[model samples]
Target: MTRLGRIIQRFQSDQGGAALVEVAITVPLVLLLSAGVFEFSNILNTRLLLSAGVEDAARYMARCSDSTWNNCVALGKNLAVNGAVTGGSARVTGWTTAEITVGKTSTAAVDGSGTQLYLSSTGTVDVVQVSTALPYSGVVFWDFLGFGTIDITASHQERVVGW
Candidate 1:
């Protein structure tokens, strides 16, 4: 073969380390994809847990008298931790007694309300609002993605059923 033709043929025949190079390029991508999936799943799980906890507490306290409000808050914290537990870790570590807010309101904004504690209303028609503010950090892959801490809040309102 001529010089240029020989060079081209030799280059095409040199397949050494090609598989290694390909693997090197794809491994990181696969790892990143897997980490992202794990992170997203954790976040979704925590969100659902928070929602359930808030709703449960609100419903439970809705039927009780005002004297039992502390019980409602305590129950809310427990429910929140139970709901958020995964892989032996509580996703919402900020779920504490001080973070739980129990209040009475006259509006339907209970579901979308912030963590702020509204004044307790003594009226029979008032709705009890239970809310918690959770700090979310990705469990598996958050550091790899350079994501910062996220604050998620869950709130629910249930109308009083008894005096």
Candidate 2:
């Protein structure tokens, strides 16, 4: 066979692990992305729940002027139990220097402000923080290839929404 033909024959007879090489390079990257996506989705779900919980707490407080801080906390906890909010911790606090308060409107107006039992606002800030640690099992190929679980910590504050 001619040199070119001989080269072609050699090429045809020899096998190259090109696919494995490509996969080795691409698989980890894909897995990393998959892990990130999963973690982000989990964080988003947690945020949605926290937001709803805080909103519910504020709503309850706005309506129930006679309600105490404990009462608002209970409202938030109960709302969370409905499964609208999942993962992380939740609590309600009111009237802190670190927080902004709008006194009740219907209730006796808080001095210095005309607002009473209407809707007092408090900055939930870190007071209502939810933290979730998620473990992403990674992509199917990555996990099978030896990649381990990805750990993610998602945290956020829930603001008090009055009225």
Candidate 3:
């Protein structure tokens, strides 16, 4: 055989199992990319849910009378957190009354008969902040590195004007 032929033969023999090595390295990379995709999507979904719930709570509270502050808070709390925000992390504050001046006359605004009433809703949730080693949900192959949970918070206010 020619000199080139001998060189090719040796290379082939030496690299017999290189494909396996390549695959071993590539597989982990692929899996890591996929896990990142999943975690990011989860975060997006969580954000969407939070936004919708905040809007819903604000709407409900705006419809209630000023006297129904406590009940309105309860209603808002229900809509804002789907058990996602544990303990006292989630909150619903009544800003309309707080905004009303102490000696301010019952103008058309505070008359409560206005076309709209202001409502407020705020929420917080634990999110994976750091996922360098563990997975978002805590799995090895699926580990996002337990990036650590962050408090996802949302706040909004709206008005219900119709009589």
Candidate 4:
């Protein structure tokens, strides 16, 4: 064979750079996948925290007494944001009471199939709902991904049990 042919054949048969080439091609993909998993978990965790806070606030409001109802709404908002009725550190970063909403709704005590579920004399149940929307702040800038401001929204409802 000619010199050029021999060189080309040897180069084709060489395995020295094969693993390096494969690693270089796969490293970025693996890193991207790992980062995605981490970000998803982080977002999920924040959502859970927000849900828990809303649930706690709803539960508190549901059992609140009529005399204290005026202050109960503010306390519920504080609980939803600070994880305490008296206010403290927030469960999620950048969360605030302004982002939380406390609402009262009267819903019929019936199942989805329209079957009466409660035997209450009033035939209607009062529900206290707490909801909040918190913008996700993660390691990656969501704006750069062309999705502006991912929000982690959570809400909870509880039947009013006045004391």
Best by TM-score: 4
lDDT of 4 by residue, 1-163 (tens): 9999999998997999999999999998898788778877988999999999999999999998747776999888888888888948888888888999889988888878989866677868898889999987577734445676688899999988875
- Lowest lDDT sum, 10 consecutive residues, model 1, at 82-91
Candidate 1 global TM-score: 0.69
Which of the two, 2 or 3, has more TM-score?
3
What is the per-residue lDDT of model 3 for residues 49-79, given as tens digits with 9 covering 90 to 100?
5555565556655554556556555545554
lDDT rank, highest first?
4, 1, 2, 3
Q: Model 4 off-target regions past 4 Å? A: 1-7, 111-114, 117-119, 141-144
Residue pairs with colliding backbones in model 4 are none
Q: What are the lDDT figures for the candidates, one per model?
A: 0.69, 0.46, 0.45, 0.86
Clashes (backbone N, CA, C under 3 Å), per candidate, total 0, 12, 17, 0
Which candidate leads in lDDT?
Answer: 4
* TM-score for each of the candidates: 0.69, 0.42, 0.52, 0.85
- Candidate 3 lDDT (Cα, 0 to 1): 0.45
* 37-122 per-residue lDDT for model 1 (tens digits): 87888888788878877886777677655576666556655555554222234535556657778887565322354533343443
lDDT of 2: 0.46
Off by over 4 Å in 1: 1-9, 65-94, 107-124
